[model samples]
Target: MTETTAPAVGHQHDGPHGYASDKGAYLKRMRRIEGQVRGIARMIDEDVYCIDILTQVSAVTKALQAVSIGLVEDHLGHCVVDAARASEAEGAAKVKEAADAIGRLVRS
Candidate 1:
């Protein structure tokens, strides 16, 4: 893998919404995670060893968490920031609400 960094928000890397933008990297990550999930399902059907299946299950969990964190970052960098800049009254509240939701997800 190339040494990498996420380009600054709303720069050339930003897509239509200027926030929640995909540098295409995010989609690719999700696709890989999806494949991993399918593989896990197959392992179950094929009666794979419990330890091996659990290892892959762990990988799937981490991949999903990574995806969620990426979206949260994009939301903050683009959507939340834009709303704040435009002086939307509920902007911060929305971000807080989202953060709380994610917190619950993480705790689960």
Candidate 2:
């Protein structure tokens, strides 16, 4: 993969409503994750060894965690920052929402 960094909040990388610049990329990643999940289901249907199935499950979990981290980073760099620029109250709300999301992710 090419090495590139995310653009700052006010930069061109900001998409509509402060979403990530590469929304399509996120969708692609999710689709791949969905495929992995389907593969795991197939393994179970085929009566694969328990350990092998668990390994695939672990891979899927890690992929999902990576996606979650990327989304949270995008939210903080884009959405939360935009809200802060708009108004302090809006920013506070965004921060709380983000914290709640992180909390849920952690509990998961």
Highest TM-score: which candidate? 2
For 1-108, candidate 1 gives per-residue lDDT tens digits of 442553433332233443235768887898899899999999999999999999999999988888778777777777667667756654766567667868987896
Give per-residue CA lDDT, model 2, range 2-97, as digits (tens): 325544333223345434587888889999999999999999999999999999999999999998998888889888898799889778878888
TM-score for each prediction? 0.73, 0.81
After superposing candidate 1, which stretches have Cα over 4 Å from the reference?
1-20
lDDT of 2: 0.82
* The candidate that achieves the highest lDDT relative to the unseen native structure: 2
